[model samples]
Target: MKTYFRLLSFARPIGRYAIPYVIYTLLAVLFGALNLALLAPLLTTLFGQHENAAAIAKPEHFYDVFKMLNYYSMKINAEHGLFRTLQFVCLTIVVSVLIGNIFRYLSERTMENLRIHTLLNLREAVFNNVMDLHLGYFNEERKGNIIAKIAADVQVVQYTVTGTLQVIFKEPLTLLTYLVMLFIISYKLTLASMVIIPIAGFIISRIVSRLKEQAAAAHTSYGTMISYLEEALGGIKIIKAFNATPYIKKRFHEENLHYSGIMRSMTRRQHMASPVSETLGIVMVSGIVLYGGSLVLSNNGSLNAAAFIAYIALFSQIMRPAKAISTSFSNIHSGLAAGERVLALIDQQSQIKDAPDAKPVHQFREAIRFEQVGFAYNERMVLNHVSLTIPKGKSIALVGPSGAGKSTLMDLIPRFIEPQSGAILIDGQNIGSVTTDSLRALMGIVNQESILFNDTIFNNIAFGKPGATMEEVEAAARIANAHDFILATEQGYQTNIGDKGVKLSGGQRQRICIARAVLNNPPIMLLDEATSALDTESEKMVQDALNNLMKNRTSLVIAHRLSTIQNADHIIVLDNGNIVEQGTHVQLLEQDGLYRKLIEMQTFSAN
Candidate 1:
């Protein structure tokens, strides 16, 4: 219930929609009931007339619609005759139906707008929160499942929640209005009908009792199937290379079947509620007939022939709203289940957040210092009491074997993942004390993989600076050696680079990534094996671009090929999260320590 209400909060200022909807609905219900209530007078006018009929006695209270209708019928018959009275009653029924339908149309329009409004707010909130979540959350959770929650689950919640709310108000009012008229005609019959109604409701509830559980299972199955589809698309090349198409096809098919089965079960249970409630309602109507007929046949004064006939007609209309309420219960259960999943995502708190007193830092004046910084994952230390300093406006390189914590150490600079212990500072100020956005603003990063979006070359280059003009983008592209190829494309810089820059060569994509980082023009550059993935010819061009970009900037490079970093002012060798050595390139070669061995190993591999 709490989760349901929390989801409802997305439709804030609901009174704006609710107030107008209520007015329209109430008016519609009023006119609709009047249409059925007029049935009594119509029957009385058609049958009650005779050759020497006297005037019908008017009820004491004017609110007694049936008696008053008869009195008016007889009065009209004496003056205007039976033909005129029949025409009058039929015309009243037509006008009542027309006005009722108009209000019904207006009410439906208002409800649709409310549903759309609720969906817009909910989808926006979930997506914004998902974007703000910590990077590790994505690592621990599946992308497909998150997409499902934000997209599919949110859609379900919007319609069902609002629809059930509509039923809660509109259906019950309709039922009550019918009941009031039923008792006015014959209280004995109305009381008997009310007794049988609860039994119908009970039966419908039991039939749909398991629908919520099935609905929850259906949502989970669908999410898992979506995840499988995403994985297959992402790794299509690998699957093709390994000749695993059949295996992948079979795997996805199994999940699809499971999801389909759950949906089929849910549909059966949901559809069953309508028929069961309707069937029970029909049974009650049958009983009403036997009893009400006796009252009329017994010449009972409580119900005249006209009143009894109108009473049964109004009673039959009662089944419509009653069936609607039962069906809405099934939908509400499904909606609540979907609501729980969506709320769980909204409730998630990011693992990283700015401190209450955190201040924003603007410049990188001195150096980034790691004072015995330590980090661990799953009880295994990835960075162990590591201490180092990257001084301002100088090139520093980290060279090591795989799993030596080179990338992890570089990630710490941007606070992508915080150290489990110890502190990192910039110009003697603790980085944690600074706002995350401002702290990251001092540095530009280019990763080992060329991460380019599916966009135009110009937009991709200017991504770091949204407002960057053509001249600035061209200059940045020149620095990264991307300007030449960009112009060589069919549209020059306007050429669209398909998904992940697949439209361009490996070298072109990497250069564009460099161009993006250069456009940012931060004081510090964190290059994580930027040239590692390129061939020798492409590597040299990218290396030259990297050299141009790093000019007069503090650079922390994770060198994949040791020969590339011979001129670096400082070379730090790491082994198992420990800094084994640090010095000038020549100084390290002279020491003949781990650095010299790495240089020798790379030299050997190059041959």
Candidate 2:
């Protein structure tokens, strides 16, 4: 319940829609009640004894008694001499129903607008927070879970918040208006009719509580299934090569079964809500009929038969709202559980945030320096008291075995993960004192995998700088050696890259990524094994392009092939998160330390 209240805050920004929906709903309910209340006079005019004619002629008297009945006596009485009056009353009822439905439609339209507006803002908020979170958070959490929260969880919240207002507010207003009309008819009978309401409400409350538990389980099962499917598809090649199709199928089936079981339980409980409430209402109606019939018989001289029958019709009208309320409560409870999940995601605070006094950095000069830097993932230290400096317009290379944290070191340069203890300075200004966006904007990164979106070749190349002219895109592509191939394709630069650029070869995709990086023209470049995925011929071309690209920029290279970084101004050899050796290529080899041993190992392997 508390979670639901928190979720409602998202709707606060869109209260313009909610306020009008409330007003429209109330108007709809008023008309609906008017339709029911107008029935009494028509009943008296048609079915009352001739001696009651004078009373029937006075619509006020007939209206008072008509509001007292619990059934459809008005239609029954319309069968006699008062046929014209019945026609008029039926026309009014039709008009009221039409107006009620109109307001109902407007209310729904408003709610839908609110849902879409809130959902868009929610997705934006979640994606923005993801960009701001520390890299360590990703190490401990699955990408699939975060995807589910933004996509599925956010959708759940939209549906629940919209449905909650409709069911809890609109339906209850409709029910309450009818109850007041019932009270005006005969206070005694209206009080009697409500005897079963508390019991029905209690039963509905119990069912809804259980439904919420099942709903929460069902939502969790959905997220788990999505995670499993994501993992299976992401590793489809491995699964197929190992003939693990049956294993994956079994796992999927188990998850589906669990999801189905919870949904079935919740559905059964929800289905019973309306029927159980209706049955109790029927029992209450039976009591009204017997008790009200006794009153008619005992007071036969005073009571008009048509008026008594009219009161019975009015009593039955009250049950519709009661039943609706019962069903709505069940839905609201289920929705609240989903709402809680969405609110939790929206409320998540990033561990890394810009400093209160942060400012945008516009230029780079001097050098980037790491002063007594240390970093950890969870409790395991990855970088310990590490300090380094790279002057502007120089090239530095990091070479190490896998898990030696070469990539982690480069990640720190970009502030992807903040150092646990120490500071990184860009041009003597602490990196933490500048906005992350401005900091990253001044650097370009190209990773080994060549990440590319499923878009046109032109769009992918222009992604680094949106709105780049076709000529500018072509120029960048030419520098990266991708222009000739792009023009040779059937669609030229307009050709689609397919999912993750799978339609392009490893070399083509890498060159396209290079083009994107070139288009940015940042002063700082971080190359994470950029040539590792290319063939020998492609590697030569890309390395030449990179050599030209790195000429005057401050470059940080994470190298896989030892020979590639021999010309680097400085080479840092790392092992177990600590720098073991640092110097020029020949100088490090002469030191006869870790760098010398690594060079000898590579030379031996090649021979």
Candidate 3:
């Protein structure tokens, strides 16, 4: 119930729709009930039971609704002819139906608006919260599952939660209105009919008792299927290249079959409720006929033949709403299942957030200091007692084999991942005491994988700087040596790059990435193997561009190819999560340690 109501809050100002809908629905139910209740008098009038004109008595008060309707009807027949009375009754029935349908239509329109509004708010909330989560959270969770929660699960919640609102409010009132009319006609028959309802409700409840459990399982199955589909699409090239298409297809097809089987089971149970409720209603109606008919035949009976027929008619229609309510219960189980998943996402607290007294960092002047920093992932340590200083306007290059924590060390400067032990200071201020956005604003990064969106080259280059002019973008491009190749494309700077700039060569993509970094014009640059994946010719061009980008900036380069960083002001060689050597490239080589050994290995591999 807590999760259900939390989902409902997204339908805020619910009163706007609720109040008007109540008014419309109430009027609709009243007129519709009156339509069925008037059947007795219509029959009495047509049968000519009160043949004499003077025998008809007028109703004393309007509070007795049925008596008033019956008296007025008889009075009209007394004054006017039989044909005129029939016309009056027929016209009243037509007007009642017309008014009832109009109110019902208005109520439906209001509910539809509520549905759309709830969907918009719920989906937006899910997506915004996802975007706010820390970078590490995405690593631990499936991308496709997140997509399912935001898109498919939110849609399910919208229909189920809001649809249940209509069932909760309108259906019960309708059922009550019918019961009142039935009681007014014959209290005994109405009481007998009441016994069957609780029995029907119990049966329906038992049938749907396991529905919530099944619904939860179905949600999981569907999410898994979505994950498989996303994986297959994202790695389609790898699958085809390695001739694993058959294996991938078989895996996805298995998940699809499992999802379909669960859905089939859930729908089977859901559809069974309606028929069961209807059958019970019919059995109760037959019992009512046997009991009520005996009363009419006996001398002490209060019901006339005409009122008895109308009572049965109203009683039969009672099951319509009852059946609708029962079916909604089954559907609500599915909705609440989905609601739990969505609310769980909304309720998840992000692990990374700024301190209450955190301040903004407007400038970076001196150096980035790491003091006895250590980090681990679940007790597997990555960086241990690692300390380094990057002074102002100087280039520092880190050379190491894989798992040496070079990239992890650079990530700490911007607080991408905080150290479990020790502290990092930016310009003498602990970065933890600064706002993440303001701290990140001081640096630019380019990774081995060039991250470019499928958009125009100008837009991709000027991504973080909104409202950047073409002149600024071109200047950055020229600095990265990307201007000439960009101009050679079909649309020049305006040409749309395919996903991750697939339309361009590897060197061109790296240059565009470098251009994007240069456009930021930050004081500090973190280059992580920017040219490691390119050919020999591409590497030379990219390395030259990198030199231009790092000029006069405080730069930290993680060098995969040793030749690129031979001229760096300082070099730090790391192995096994510890810094083994630190000096200028020439100074480290002269020491004849691990740095010189690595250079020999690479030199031999190249030859």
RMSD of each: 2.5, 3.7, 2.6
Candidate 1's residue-wise lDDT over 330-353, tens digit each? 898889999999988988999788
Better of 2 and 3 by TM-score: 3
Range of the 10 consecutive residues with the lowest summed lDDT in candidate 3: 598-607
Q: Residue 154 of candidate 1: its Cα lDDT?
A: 92
lDDT of 3 at 91: 87
Which sections of candidate 1 miss by over 4 Å?
50-54, 57-62, 603-607
TM-scores, all models, native as reference? 0.95, 0.91, 0.94
Evaluated at residue 376, the lDDT of candidate 1 is: 80
Candidate 3: the clashing residue pairs are none
**Global lDDT of model 1:** 0.87
lDDT of 3 by residue, 1-607 (tens): 8878888999998998889999999999999998887787788788847655557566676655666777777878878977788888888989999999999999999999999999999999988888878778888988888888888889999889899999899999999999888888888998887887788888889888888888888888788878888898878899999999999889878888888888888888888898898889889999999999998888474887888898889998888899889999999999999889988888777777899999999988999998999988787788889999999999999887778888888877878788899999998999999999999888889999889999999999999897999999999999999999999999999999998898999999999999999997999999988988899999998998999999989999988787678989999888777899999978998999988988888631110
Higher-scoring candidate on lDDT, 1 or 2: 1
